[model samples]
Target: MESMKNRESKTAGSLIDDPVILRLFERMPHSVQESFTEEQLMHLKVAVGSRGWGEHAVDVRGSFRGWRHRYYYVMLFGRNRRHLTPGQKRIHNLISAAMLTGFVCVGLLIGLLGLYLLKSAAGIDLFPDHSLGIWDWFNSN
Candidate 1:
């Protein structure tokens, strides 16, 4: 019990020394000091960063892709299964399916465009023989 009190007191003391943290602390009542335990204060300190409270510093080295996938999945498949009606979930699923189909169609169009460019580079006859060259059409005798 003594150690817990010591830690809490230390956290409270540190809050006074750090101006940014003091500001965050000032937003709440003096009773807030007693409300949060040492562990919670430590977490808040880390989140606020030792440099300052407004400056947010986080290490997201390799987890961004996973976070993006989870975010997209929630957006496409409705978050909180219990709260969603059956019809809502079904609509989300249909929207997801439609988006997937659109992506596939776009992929196909890009592939076709690539093939056309390749064929054009290889001197394939895309236009008829009657088609006038730009120089021929533009030149005046």
Candidate 2:
């Protein structure tokens, strides 16, 4: 009996209710939400205006008499931002970043091209009896 009762009790400050912010927080990349107080999580349900145009009619044209379920939509107002390290900031601009990436890709391509050309031009077939064109003329003689 005591164990059952203890499970139901929760801490006062802990956020037990899942709000919109809570769901969004899980998906934010490179971000951490500062702890929010429990009171801040309390949301009031708003009532929508009656559809009957303020007249209680025998034949109801359109009106909802039952309670409408609503929840406060909490938008994660601001992104969690960080001041970039000096080195990171130095390379942060789009042009700089794109240029760096482009340079790296270009370098890789150039290296591969050079290796292909080297193998193509060198004609030193590591495997015997493999014929590489043009350069084969040099060694065949």
Give lDDT tens digits, candidate 2, residues 1-141: 223123226564444334544554455552234333334433311121222323332323333344675434322333325577878777677668899999999999989766755786765466677653545464477
Which run of 10 residues does model 2 get worst, by summed lDDT?
A: 44-53
**Model 1 lDDT tens row, 1-141:** 224356546644554455555667778876665566545765777777565323324323232356447332221222232556899889989999999999999999989767765665566766757433433333442
* Model 1: lowest-lDDT 10 consecutive positions: 72-81
Alpha carbon deviation, residue 54, candidate 2 (Å): 69
Candidate 2, which segments miss by more than 4 Å at Cα?
1-92, 124-141
**For candidate 1, what is the lDDT?**
0.59
Please name the candidate that would achieve the greatest lDDT relative to the true structure: 1
